[model samples]
Target: MRSAAPAPRVIAVVGPTAAGKSDLGVFLAQQLGGEVVNADSMQLYRGMDIGTAKLTLGERGGVPHHLLDIWDVTEPANVATYQQLARAEIDRLLAQGRTPVLVGGSGLYVRGAIDVLEFPGTDPEVRARLEGELEEHGPGALHARLAAADPEAARAILPGNGRRIVRALEVIEITGRPFTANLPSHESVYDTVQIGVDVGRPELDERITVRVDRMWEAGLIDEVRALEERGLREGRTASRALGYQQILDAFAGECTEGEARAETVRATKRFARRQDSWFRRDPRVHWLSGAMEDRAELPRQALALVERAVTA
Candidate 1:
């Protein structure tokens, strides 16, 4: 009898926003005969196009990408679901003799996939209660409550992230276990080679500003208006998107268009800063910095590191 071949490993291309992760994924996929598996939470929702900076078919450069826009806006897409789906797809790709490259700025999603985090399953009753509390007490108040309940989890999650904070608290409330308690004990699912791209703070800030401005000009407000017209208002997943929220405020006469643009820029910058902070804490990632260096050389260096990791 023939022995089963080993499972294919993963190559994770993770970094902050505007770090050319998507472009690099495409380039590497083509170079290494691989498929790209998305790890971004926002990009998983259909019709959240502009705000998420989701890749278009053309932008994919004919490379196969998976797990993007595979869910409805109303459905909850959590890390557990992502890990299951991503692993399945990676297996399929390997069966077809292709590498799988995970690409995104979502720190939690990437870590969840690689680390095999085990989140508590959802309970409809508990979820409804959490949703009600979100409506009545507000996300901030509920987040504070979670902070008191699970300080470590609260510290790990962003306080401003209503969806995650609420979900974390709901898991604790429903399962009678802390959110962190459900996670696996430092065991990684994949033998991954992590390539983290970095740029100078000033350069990254400039890139963010430019990207936000381009997005605004690309009818991001129009997209937000369309989503709102479709009844995706505040408290909905679609509305919580960075650019969408700012534009929604403008649509409600809460801010001027210019004010909305500025807010979007500022929020994106802050998000990128948080991403940088999160990735830096991981010593496993090999950091690449400096915009003055050749951009194409970045992927080459990453590929070399990954190839070495796989062989070693």
Candidate 2:
């Protein structure tokens, strides 16, 4: 009898913002006969298009994309929920003998989808206490406390991200262990090959500037205005997104529109650096140059890497 063929492998496209991960993901999905599952946290919110650089239907090139625009702007981000949704899509695609291309710059969401990771259960009382402290003293104060308790977790989470800080503290309280200690080792639940789009800092910075400019020109202010009407300001996660936060400040008369635009560019650059650092620490990702000169070859190189990983 003939030997059975190996199971289909999942593909993940990851990198900093403006590294061309989205287009590359579409190309891979088309080439591999797969569907795209979004991993970007911001893109999960509905009506967050231009700021998130979410792809249009035409840009998707007829390849089905999953998990995009699935949440309302008022809803808070929940990676644990995302993990469940992403895995369901991946398993559905796999069951049909098709590859599932997971793509985004959100490092934890990507890992949650494919890794053997377990999120710690939440305690309402603990969460309420931490949230109360966050409201009373601000995220920086709580972040300082977290740094004292779990330096590594504090390093991974941004100081301004109160929700994450609260979650970390809650986990520490519940488990009586460091938050980082609860993270799973580098073990995967699925056979996945992660392709990281690589671009130098200089080029990446320029790309982010241009991308932010384009977002402004494409009516990001209007998008924020629409979402604001839908309680975007009430959403903890959505309200704090890079461009949206800056624009919202402008709307509140805290800054001029031009200042908001400039700040958005700067903030996006900082976020890109953080994203690069996060993905660089992962040993399993295969890096491919996303330089403008090499753009034509990126998909081909990525496909070759996937083939090598699958066969090896």
Candidate 3:
């Protein structure tokens, strides 16, 4: 009797922003006859295309992509919800004998999709009080409090990220533990092969600068303006997105457009370093060079790696 073939493992293309993750994801999906499930948190929002560097339909090489633009700008990001949605898609793809390529640089979103993670319930009263504090004292003050409570969480989250700071505080209050303490250890829910796109810091910084420049050139400001009409400012998560936040500052006369552009470059570069640090901590990822000279070989190397994992 012939044994049934094992199901295809989920493939995650991950790394810092502008590290060629999207393009590599598309290539792997095309080669493996798979669909893409977005793991980029910002790319989940509608009308956040240019800043998120979302791949155009044409750029996707006729491959089916899932979970991109699934959320309204007004909706707060829920990793638990995203985990449910991503697993459903991955299960469906595997059932149909196709591969599922999970793609993005949002570390938590990626982990939520494939990791054995559980989120604590929110307490409305606690949340409200923390939110009030955030509004009154600002993110910096709350961040200092978080630093005292969970310096690890504070280090992971940006001080200016009021929404996350509030969430961390809320979680701490609800769980009676540090927010980082609530995170599960390295255990995966799915048989996932993470491919980390590796690029040198200097090169990655340059890539980010160019990518941000292209976003501005490609009418990112116009996109932000359009989304602003749809209550972007009221959308806590959307308004705090890296490029969008800087642009919002410019819109409010907080800075000149040129200053916003330069700041975006600087901020993105810093973020890329953090991203690199996050992925490097995971031992399971198979690192692949994303240099322009190595572009042609990446898909082949990635496929070979996946095949090895499948066979082993």
**Stretch of 10 with least lDDT, candidate 2:** 1-10
Task: Order the candidates by lDDT, highest first.
Answer: 2, 3, 1
Greater-lDDT candidate between 2 and 3? 2
Candidate 1 deviant stretches above 4 angstroms: 1-8, 183-185, 290-294
lDDT of 1 at 215: 89
Q: What order do candidates take by TM-score, descending?
A: 2, 3, 1
Best by TM-score: 2
RMSD of each: 4.1, 2.9, 2.9
Assess candidate 3 and give its TM-score to the true structure.
0.95
For candidate 2, list the clashing residue pairs, or say none.
Answer: none
lDDT of every model, 2 decimals: 0.81, 0.92, 0.89
lDDT winner among the candidates?
2
TM-scores of all candidate predictions against the true structure: 0.90, 0.96, 0.95
Task: Estimate the overall C-alpha local distance difference test score of candidate 3.
Answer: 0.89
Candidate 2's residue-wise lDDT over 70-157, tens digit each?
9998998998999999999999999898889999999999999999999989999989989999999999999999999999999999
Worst 10 residues of 3 by lDDT: 1-10
